[model samples]
Target: MKIYSYPSHVKQDIKEFIEKRLDSGTFGLLVQGDEDTIEDVKDLMFDQDDVTGNGSGSYTFNTLKAEECLVGNWDLLREAKEELQPNVDLIEKGPEFCDVMIRCYLLDWCFNKALAEIVNNTETVQKGDN
Candidate 1:
């Protein structure tokens, strides 16, 4: 899930794995800065909106969005794990991809200390026409 580059799995392939069940798609990748160093860091946008178990959702653009959502709706960030179950076989499952899935969810949240949406360099385009 490196920033400004394409995602690991294809968009549609992973979409079906969680479509209508979970929000999953590499809509775009972002490069946000580290508040401490002012240096650009890689980030990604795995889901269009908050990984609401349902299809539709709103972008996280408020203060303490993650914390508030965690307290108010545990499923907000939790359902991501349950949703990605099939992506990995239960037999060979570990904490790797699941961690990516979670980070993908958390990265899109704005005003969360490190949220930047500037397109500096694009390695690939994830659109219909290039």
Candidate 2:
């Protein structure tokens, strides 16, 4: 997602703002701005937060009048992400945790499939006996 904070022409503030949010553990994905002039005001919202599980805040980059920063609360972002991918706790540390999650998901899928197959086989055997 791309965030357009007012003063898209003010590159420094936009970059600084995003970096601060990232360092604050507000997002997992990296943000990039400064698309135009170094002084151009703009902010880039990257992939949704992974570890933090947050969504992009709202904002308008270019407007006729001086625009107020439409910042989305971090809590709301967290809620939104949770709704989508709530199984994994976003606060877990590092890539190892992510790997564990993946493994868990795969195991769950396999277990479910095996259970279904067993049920089908059992039903078949019962019908044959009858």
Candidate 3:
């Protein structure tokens, strides 16, 4: 598996967050946002609104907005997570932690999508040369 690295601060914050969750037995914590936020995430992942359909009504998905959303959300969550302290109430810090987890998952999706695109394009170009 490829090793993913974060900035020192983000890496430290994630380590502490995981330790706190384990210590508090909060492993079941759910990360969720409002419906509008959910829709925004979908749009960021798929560019849902920009999709087009062929004459036979089969839709083509072209854009991937994951990298853009991931970068922005990661920065925001990093700032919020950095403000957390060991003494801070878990209730107060839960939302920020959830945001960080959610963004991390999104970043994983973005990285996978980018990799798939690179592979697919390379295959297409190779086939064209035949």
TM-score of each: 0.24, 0.24, 0.25
- Candidate 2: residue 78 Cα off by (Å): 20
Which has the greatest TM-score?
Answer: 3
Pairwise TM-score winner, candidates 2 and 3: 3
The residue ranges of model 1 lying beyond 4 angstroms of the native Cα positions read: 1-77, 82-91, 110-113, 116-130
Q: How does model 2 score by TM-score?
A: 0.24
lDDT of candidate 1 over 40-98, digit per residue (tens): 22121344343322222232444244334334333433565566543545224323333
Q: Ten consecutive residues with minimal summed lDDT in candidate 3? A: 47-56
- Compose the digit string of candidate 3's lDDT tens values, residues 1-130: 2222333323343333333433322322212223453344334433211221112222222112222223445454454345533354535534433333433434434433433444466578879999
What RMSD value applies to candidate 3?
19.3
lDDT (tens digit, per residue) of candidate 2 on 21-101: 435323222212222421221112221222111132212213221122223323433443454457656455333333222
Q: Against the unseen true structure, what C-alpha lDDT does each candidate score?
A: 0.33, 0.32, 0.36
Q: What lDDT score is found at residue 119 in candidate 2?
A: 45
lDDT for 78 in candidate 3 is 53
